[model samples]
Target: MKKILAALLIVVSQNVLAQTTQKPVLHGKNWVAITGKPLAATAGAMTFQKGGNAVDAACAMLAATCTMWDVLSWGGETQALIYHPGQKKVFGINALGVAPSGATVDYFKDNDMEYPPAFGPLAATTPGTFGGIITMLAEYGTLSLKDVLEPAMQMAQGYPIEAQTANQIESNKDKVKEWPYSKAVFLPHMGEEREAPHAGEIFVQEDLYNTLKKLVDTEQKALSEGKSRKEALQLAYDRFYTGDIAEEIVRSVKEQGGLFEMEDLANWQVKIEDPLHVNYKGIDVFKLREWTQGPALLQSLNILENFDLKKMGYNSANYINTIYQTMSLAFADRDFYYGDPDFGQASPMEGLLSKQYAKERAKLIQERNVEDIGPGDPYPFQGGTNPFKDLLEKRKDALSYFEPENPISGLEDPFLEEFLLGTTTVQAADAEGWVVSITPSGGWVPAVIAGETGIGLSQRMQSFVLNEKLNPFNVLEPGKRPRVTLTPSMALKDGRPFLSFAVQGGDTQDQNLLQFFLNVVEFDMTVQEAAEAANINSYQMQSSFGAHESKPGAISLSTQTPPWVRNELKKRGYKMDFQERTSGPINAIWFDWKHGTFWGGSSNHGEDYGIAW
Candidate 1:
């Protein structure tokens, strides 16, 4: 009986190993691109083959993702980091929407709600995806909006829903079925059953196709009058933000008891600004400022730079522990200091990225595991009072009301919950030196599909805090953008563009990117090898959503990690959970400046694709 059991186990193990698919490192000299979905990559590749630059291809891919990836819709938030070699500068576009004028904490209090509902018109923010892509094209792209949007429009008309999209729709069918418009789109064939489409089944959004076609027509009408491409692009933008589409969206939200209004749409625009970056080892890693969690990557990198990472060795217990500890401290600072920089009185950039602050914060990581740490006094380095101290203390008292009583399983934890709120990413680079990395998110499952527009309003308002006194990201006046977790990353090696990449893991985006970056620069691994390696994720700080829950000393390791490493981490008094693999389906493109070639890799965890030509 024992011998028979051993033979069965060996067959099972072999079967499991055979089922695993290995992704290849895609390479090209002229251009390379990667996206969260295969069709999105095809759209990008088609654009590139049509003589479009990186910006053009990236915008095309973004639109295609909105159509094919149900998690991202036309009415979503987008943040991009673009590198323009001609200007020798990197620019960030903050395309995240803000709370409406009626979105005060008092408003929710009157409704008898402590937090915004995850899926409803009340949680919707002004859609920014349209404005963001149009703005990028107008400023940097050489292709017409019509040209880039053609593939996406075709896709919206009808496309085969992949397994991931099908699974997501099925998982949220109970909530989505309640919204007639959403049900009409995601469960069109269910006929009261609310079943998701089977994989490879044709899924069409006629309203979405019409909406995109209208934008194209709007641009063409302007061009017929001999308007420049930029003028025509602005007309397309106005069509979405200030024209009929905006009116329809506002009307739908208002009818559903939500607070969106025409004024919010009319005033919506993507903010173009300089990017924030830190020099780690020899490379300069770039990200957006505080409105998003991009700076957390910089802060964490700053902290980790204090250690000789190479000496510690990649994936070593000491290395993993140090990175997690550093990440925890950085995330703590993020919870306190990261808010809309335009609305805040002080900025923590100087102190948070300073080497001195990193050294001081690094001391918090001792031999044994240290759990949750509060935000440090970064203001002293900036010559300002720390605004978060009082708020932190107040929050500590409020923790009794928020922290979970039972220890949660890793699968059902807040990290996975927030991550399920899904995002999609695209990376494109042309031989001419333009590179763009964009993360488009929101309008997730159970989204409120606006009336007849094929647009789903973003539930980004859930990111805002109802506690005005204790939350720096508190709901106050209208038009103040909520602090977001959508972070896109880029890097420069020796004053030249070197890499463009972004992932869609909510708070884990930066954490995963940090590991991938270290894998390449610190350990001399290829982009594919680095991305596929086992990694660690920490939940030792407040989550970006829900009750902002924090599980002190909580960390997750890839099950693929060696048993000795896991045991060593356990011996160090750290709380650990093991996952089958890393969280991200990260997409990245590495620009090999020395050889003038582009190397790309996309995670196969989902239906991600990498194409080069």
Candidate 2:
């Protein structure tokens, strides 16, 4: 019986480790590009074919997705992790917009609002995507801004609208009508039953096209005046922030009762920052700073390093409980501790990512689910007293009030909808060794176009809290950035880039990424397999989107999850739900150092696609 049991265990291990992906792994000798739309991915490939490096290709892709409105636009935010081959270093691009001048905690609370409205002119931040794109092109790319913006420019002239976006506009036509500029753009047939454009209909945005042209024209005009490449790029950047573009943006925003001003646009600049990192075994994983929820992934990894995940088996009951409980602990810290580090109070990030802190937190995990997981104290680990001790106690007492709504079996629940708010990801790599992973989001369908700019204003200001008790560092204030959900990930083995990855789900970004990383590293799955694998999502963390609520004991499992595993998790006190697909459009690129090539992965969850050569 013992021999038979050992043989059965080996067979189960083999089945768990081996996976056949729905899509083939994209192989590239020169470059690879993957994103949320086929046309956007093609745009990256076009840039690479034009003799541009990975950064240039990535910028092209970002611009194309914005033009295509793949859950983002020019007025949205951009966050990225780029692996620079020249410096052998990973650089972070913090282009997330800051709260406008009138955006204050008291201002929102005075309106009797729990949080900022989820969408509208009033929810906008200063536009950040264009600044991020131009900065990347000028600093790291070798191509001209015109060269990279060409693909997006042509698409803005007229591109076939996809069904997903078209239908989203149709479904939200009521809300879209609230913004005059948006109504003018989205509803081409205002009187028709189907006001939104049809799938394959030629959708033209002459305003957007002209807006892009102005930037390109500015660069050319600067070059004609004998300005250097970097100087020319900076001039074009100025055109958007402090020039005619800024004037128009401010005019329209004020006309629509939004809180944008000339100074907000002028003062908002792209920040080049060093990314946070944690060494997991031999691989050094990098993420954007605590300003985003990125540090939570590092904290989760530190705790997870204490166990051998492979022995636990993939998606096993024990593995699910471990990941679920571990994520709860990490995200609990994220909710209370993570915020814009450059603002009001400093985050104890040093202690949050400490191995000792992780071990201490890990020891709190029990045989069953921890229903009342709260933020752990990291101040002592960093040799300081807990300044938020009183707040922590208050938070623990209030956790019960924030408990998830009665368990809903299906995916249509309001909590799940808010938890899975979407974004779009961009991944690109080149033979010269430059790599980029970007998660650009905000301004999805039903977005309010900011007047004739044809740019959809970002609703990211909704991410901020109006009270210090919710999150002191993330309180809404003039010129302060909100704690965002967007995070781009990169990993380095030895001294070389190993992986570049990002996904499109809010709050669940790090949860999916942690599982994806383990899938590739510990399970030895191909990048494609890892991208397609089932990932359990925990709603135990406060959402970064509408309402800012959390479901402490709720967990979503993939339909492919075995019945026995489901039953086991239930026994551990989980309120379970199931979904046909749980992996939220993860796009990744793995550097095959031995083969001197790149392997790209685009999840089958959505319209995400990839191209390689």
Candidate 3:
């Protein structure tokens, strides 16, 4: 009997060690609902149908998405903004959380080796992003918190498993190894030992369910009692921050040596600031600053303005080369200067976005084949070319490039490891010619402070560092939100909202944004066509880190572009990389200022679908 039991256990262990699934795919257009995910979209769309404005719909969807798709949810923070044509005001909300008041850099000085793996406790910043939604609802939204939270509160109560949800849970099981609470909430069906389960599995979260029950009860009861808006919001915030849920998180973070403080929670405030605004060729562009690398998004538009993108053809090799030249310069600046403006000043804003810099940078995009041009305004390393064609090649089982066992680095062909952290973006427009663009995420991992609140703090710490060659007074510190790779954006031409867009796949975000923006703004493609157009991701060309030296300009291009475009780009001194899809799908909405109603479109290059009513 003992021997038989051992054999059974062995079989079970092997199954747990090996789990796989088709990666989740959620794509859409028309921007009916925009939040952290599709689940949020569904919830928000329902609210919209129930007579909510974009802000109401967004707030509701964002809250619900935090629970339904909490992988990118609260317990961390959310920094978001909106432009309302009806009000003609750009509202900004900083929903980011704050670091523990007591924690300091000395905390990490004692344990550099164990220093919370960048995304770990040492990376704990703040978790106040949802405050943005709260502030928006209070200021611009029509519905009460009770009305908006219903969809989210409902989803938290014993919700059935979604295929994508289950798949994400399974795919991220290894990530759960550090937190038992997460294991219980996610791997409930995986046996007592907490292991990965097969597909079609039904996992339940009793603790999360209870947490949802409290949130729902407060929300539902508020509506039943016809509570005032302030009362309802206070109730919700109290439940999350001052009640049991808050205690639960505080205990967790304390145990983890995190820097979160109750005062940070108590004094938490979301302020409405103006977005970083700029104009390009009669188009107005805006990106919320502070927590996002939004300036980078704007810089792309500025640089493209210096070139004649339309003359190069939409996906021509020369066109893609110009893109590489522009973005590499922009990103080089991003790596050097971007940070929390509250704590530091960014010098690159002037030079990076300047037409003079763009003109200087344009010279590097040689018309004919040119030899390796040294990286401009970029970190110095080595060899590479922007090979746009590389992204177009087909990918299947073997495309992952790296498996657990391989753990590759310093190879003949270096990988852009930065691609590991995924992000989410939404671009949609309202019927009133108001465009909506939002980028919400904490990159992969906890981004990583845990056990503090309902959600883990973001691991956005790795992106910031001290500058050696430039200004000083910027010492890495606690309580500061690190500048992110996210740069959700929009553009206006002749005082009309021309484009609503965002690129959300980490390092690829900026690259994809540059190409798609040029494709539409300069190359005259439709919104959908612009997003779908073939392009290259500069990261693949330079391989993020290792090949930053040896990386030839290997551009990762989508396969749809003309073959001649690839050959021509190569002839123009550019290197090409082939990936089935190099850039991530971009979501966009454009408003015809002359026309009263809004026109929306979805990117066809990926799993995108759009809607407008």
Candidate 4:
């Protein structure tokens, strides 16, 4: 009996060890990539096999995500950071939708609401995902839109729902049942007494498949008319933004009693702009400008550059405190200063990113935590008055409202749940040194599917402030882009593309990326090891949601963190919260310039996938 028990113990130990081992980092000579879903990654790899470049692979992966992932939709918001080796330039594509022409402060006031509802036609904005993808393909991609979208169309026609997708569908079933079109796509057997689709069950979306097919058919028709590939792509894009599909979208929103018109769709266009960057040591980190929270990472890095992070030690109490405090100061400035630069007047981009300003702001980081420090006076350096100063003073009585309401709420206001739950990411790198990092989000469970179009409208309008009087981001103009949180990041080492990475968490997106970058750059860890490491999140600044709450001195530490660190943080007067994970799942690919190899890593915390070949 003793011999038999000992043999069984050995077997059990081996099984546990096998399960606990970390997955190896994906490596390849030709290419490597990581995306939010396995099928999406497979589509990207297939694109590469078909002689597609990194831009083409990334576009294909994102399109597949729209089909396979329940968290993203066909008509959503997408932002891309593309690095072209030939030009030695990084371009930013701001595909976030803007408020409708009919969206005014008076409209919400007339409806007896302070903010738009979390989920409904009222929350919808003009769709930008289709246009954004087309723009990328037109400029940089070698594959046609039809070729890239083929896999997504098939997946939409019918695919087995995975466990994660089934869970997401089930969680939103109550909202899905309210909209006939949504119910048809997500819970088809509603009246038949069946629950949401189960894992491994065949989930078909005929409407969505038809919707994608229409775009392909339009592109092909344009090609048949002797149009160039770029011209053909533009025609197809116009079909969605200004043709029959746009008409259908407008009709659906109006019929549903929402504020949207054909003019909004006709005037929509994706903005291609130069990316913003900051040099850390010798590497240059790139991100979108003020329209996103991307600049916050640069600001944080600027401040952190003053500290000896390596000397502080990785995951040490001193390192965590310093990073958290620095992030708090940067985010405070972001909440006040970051907005749609075109509509929000002049943003303090130059001053906020200036080394001198960062040095000045770094002084705010103390031995203990602080909260709601508010925006700084960057006008002296970048040329703009502090817009939030008056608003902050006006809401001084409600200052407590800025902190996150619940300690365990994960940066979401319970009162505004659906509006905050969104975002997913994909990244790819090819042999020619082209790299793309794209985040496609919005138009998920909280959004209503437009009638018969199979395209779900984005709830990005909720990111806009309802009170346009004092809020720079709340201007109710038709073409004004909302201050969005969808940020993708890229880095260059010695004037060449080094890394492409992104994540899904809304406000935590930049924070997650900043930590991952520090892990790899300062601690000298591999991409996989850096991504797998535990993270800390500070909730001491205003949220980027409707409520805009902040939790003073509140910090969350991942459970994987050492207990002693938690105690140290608590001793420092931080209102500590424990979480299984503190940030979104990261998908990243790193290029080794000297070795001519690609390395990829994906978060094991979720259903993310990484591949190289």
Candidate 5:
């Protein structure tokens, strides 16, 4: 009997290890590249193979993903967190576009719109990805602009369109037809049953190719004239913002009835700033400041630090409830306080990120769910007074008319659908100790193409609010960036690189990231196990996209959750929804300093892929 029991124990242990992850963790000794598409990951690998560092490889991957329209384009925004080995510090890249002149709260309200339009040329801000890419290359990267852009330029000439993007175009053809320039490029098969390209069809963008070539040409000309590398790169940047390319962009946008003027493009510039960080359990996590929703994750981590999460047990009813409540607390502050730091009344970032504030917020979690969670007064922590006390009192009434709707028999929940609006993520790391995490988004499908440039205009304007009560700091204003959902994350332990990670789902970006971090740090899960792990999402926060709808008390769980766990959550007042997979296509790299290697993980949730060597 003892012999039989010993054999059974060994078998069970092996099975438990096997079931931990569906995808294999990529082990690398030199470098690793991961992103939203396989081809884009390959682009990063190609750059790495050519002796480019992680920053150069990351730039190549970003450019390729933009060219492929992997939920983004050249006209979209790019937000990144890069770790420099020599400095032993993480830097923030604020390449997000600013609202163009004339895009004020009064301008939107005068059109009888509660918020900016969700699509078309009128929805665009000044393009930022081009400027962002050049800035990173000129500052930290060793490669020339031509070397990093070669793969994307070739792809812009022609590449096979993936089914997901192709089908997205076909389904949104009606809206695409509304924009003449977009219709000309997207509807190659006009009048046919399928107006968009079929899967695997060679999708070509001649004008986009020429636009990229023009930047390369300008850089080459400057270099031939004995300009420094940085000077040559600056010349290319000037050509885009102030030269002929700017002229064409202004003319095309205006012709399409957009509000863009020459100054909008010419005056726009990318800013490199210090990123924010909070140390949790000796591990330092870094994210961009309030302009994006990055700080919310830090806030959540700070709150969770007060809990004995591992003792609560992973995915237990207790654990899920704790996480959901903590996220609600952090996100409530995010919706009300996070916005462009350069504009409007300054947000109390120091107060909001205060450890004392998190401890106070953590005290609010009770045995039952807090359905009416509202923003907390954080000003006192930083020695300031609350200026929007009246607004806080009237906040609940703002969305009182839209009661939480019950799930219909077979219909999709519109709130959930919009809540999960996703983009693509990029992560790259090299043996030289450089690491990059990025969440570039906007200019997704149904985007309006600027005439002759073949570049789709970003629809990120929809993220703004016209009412001060909803988010006073984020209210629409000319040249002010709207509060965005794109967030990339990184962690360091004992002053050494620990993890580089990011995800796609819009508002769920930080929610998923917070859990992914805990899975590895607290539970000892492998990077792949952490990436593919089931996660629960909270829908208590206001949507950042169309209509800005939210459903309080609603929560999504993995279908794998047991019946008893579901019943326990229901008893806690959560309206439970389930999915086979709740992990947003999370991509991560674990720096194994002990082993002197890298471990890469890409979630099986989507087309996200990674390559390592």
Candidate 6:
């Protein structure tokens, strides 16, 4: 009986790995969790110390986060990228929203709107993020839903508004002027704001609190009712999406000129995606696939590994120039072909990363002058193709067109606005492994609301192109997800989880990840140092495709780079945003092999985030 019981443990453990990540590594019984909030990170790590694994910790933190941060909430859809070390497989969770059955490009054109607004009920989609968290916890964690969720529930009922959160709300207060629901939640009172939202002021969300309770209570009842894991998950999902709440949401959207229906909500499914895998030198760096710009990080690494960066020197004139030019090529491909696998497909990893293509693309760089690059086929990009193109177009044509006007001429976008919009959480556990998740759907603005159902929807559609574009086998579909720049990543040495990371800053996310990947694998730098170093970011889109585009060679260098290195890139005709620091909040965890100690943290910058334990 003893032997049998032990064998059962092995089997269960094996299956857990199969469900969550691709690479698992160990360094003693230590654990780490990092996110935007210090309290939440500590809360998740507490679960780990209390015998919870990564999944349990993540579940706990995500719940707590909904109340603390509005970046990606239960109010909005969530997309998760997870890595399980024991299974040697990386898994991606697409918790993003789905368009209604009635959605079409012409729906907006008839209404005289160029692009969909990022707020209100019309922007609402089936929020599957919370449901997704529950699924992951049940399948890969040991804690009960009730046990893991209690902290967040309590926090949600009356979590104090944080200073950073309050500041963000204060900064973007104008965006909420249209929605009374949003103002009531964010602006509790006049001046004399509480010292801190978390410590003094009482931040209340009665609806969110009640909503969380229903999920926890329903999960408990399902368990008592003797339901299977999958059954219980469906119950909770239906409760929020297809059951009573969904009905209410649909009604509300109707009043607000929104595009949502029961069928569209029902059609939403969590897709299991192939992890973005790359062999950099001998080590493996796993990331979310081309659905995001994640593969570009690996592609950059593949080329950099061929050259000794330190030899060229860190942040050296030549080194920075080479990295910039290489990154531009990857970005050009990204803009031309990347989109949701259900929408358009842009293969970044194909023959594109080949010695032939790499050498060919690299030849485009003179290491002196910036050569302009739009979008081109290096080796016939064939990452993967979408299967729903023909059907999508038919569905789009169902709607009629309104008054047609000439496209906006002469740099139509007349706004001088700088944007910083991204959110993420990084964690690791002794028994479970490490996790790096960038749950970015929207930025810090009116796009989200305090107590609204779909708190500021993710501006993911912004990643889509206005022009009809063709990828290898994928094309842009109205309202479909754009090829994002979010990449939750892991560093593994021979199938062992070494480090886990995800950085903020749109296009900078991949660029930042590449630097850290090399730091850990090539330069033998600690995770902290790698993430702490300065960053050089390239453009994901044309920045703005008004009447002109900032094509390749139109790269921007952060001012933090020494003037000498900056001069080299400037002389090459690259644009620059000299900032005190133009990087992002890079969160990460590292498991040391020789010392048997695990140390991890979030970036020192990005004032909104922190690391605990």
lDDT of each: 0.82, 0.91, 0.56, 0.80, 0.91, 0.59
lDDT of 3 by residue, 18-114 (tens): 5221121223333354444555667767777777777777677666656654446555556565777877766566665544565444554455532
lDDT of 5 at 394: 79
Q: What lDDT score goes with residue 346 in model 4?
A: 65
Instruction: Name the weakest run of 10 consecutive residues (lDDT summed) in model 4.
Output: 411-420
Candidate 3's TM-score reads 0.78
TM-scores of the candidates in the order shown = 0.94, 0.96, 0.78, 0.93, 0.96, 0.82
Model 3 per-residue lDDT at 415: 54
Task: Provide the global lDDT of candidate 2 against the true structure.
Answer: 0.91
TM-score winner, 2 or 6:
2
Better of 3 and 4 by TM-score: 4
Give one digit per residue, the lDDT tens place, for model 1 in 465-566: 767434565444578777788989999988898778788777788888889888888898777777677778776666666655667766778887889987
> In model 4, which residue pairs have backbone atoms overlapping below 3 Å?
402-549, 402-550, 403-549, 403-550, 403-551, 404-550, 404-551
Residue 300 displacement (Å), model 4: 0.4
Model 5 clash pairs are: none
* Residue-wise C-alpha lDDT for candidate 4, range 1-613, written one tens digit per residue: 9999999999998877764315568889898767888888888988888899989988988898888754778778889999888998999998988888777778887988766665788888789888899999999999888899988988888888898878777877888777777777778666655567888898888878888899999889988889899998998888888888888888988887777888888888899999899999999999998888899999999999999999999878899999998888888778766788877466778999999899999898888776556666776776556655666566444443534344555435362242235477888998897899998887876458888888887877767666643355545556777777789999998889878888887777888899999989998878887777777877676666666566677777887778888888878777766677654587888888779899887886678887799
lDDT of 4: 0.80
Candidate 2 or 1, higher lDDT: 2
Error of 4 at 259 (Å): 1.4
By TM-score, the candidates rank as 5, 2, 1, 4, 6, 3
Ranking by lDDT: 5, 2, 1, 4, 6, 3
Give a tens-digit lDDT track for model 5, residues 1-613.
9999999999999987876578889999999999999999999999999999999999999999999989899999999999999999899999999898888888888889887998887789889999999999998899989999999999998999999999999999999999898888888999999999999999998999999999999999999999999999999999998999888888998898888888988888899999999999999999999999999999999999999999999999999999999999999999999999998688999999999999999999987888888899999999999999999887777752235455311115666666778889999999999999999988888898888888888988999888888888998888989899999999999999999999999999999999999999999998999999999888788989888877788888888999999999999998877888987799999999989999999989768999999
The total of clashing pairs for model 2 equals: 0
- Choose 3 or 6, whichever is better by lDDT: 6
lDDT of 6 by residue, 537-610 (tens): 55423431112133344344555677777677677666555544544577777766666667665576644344
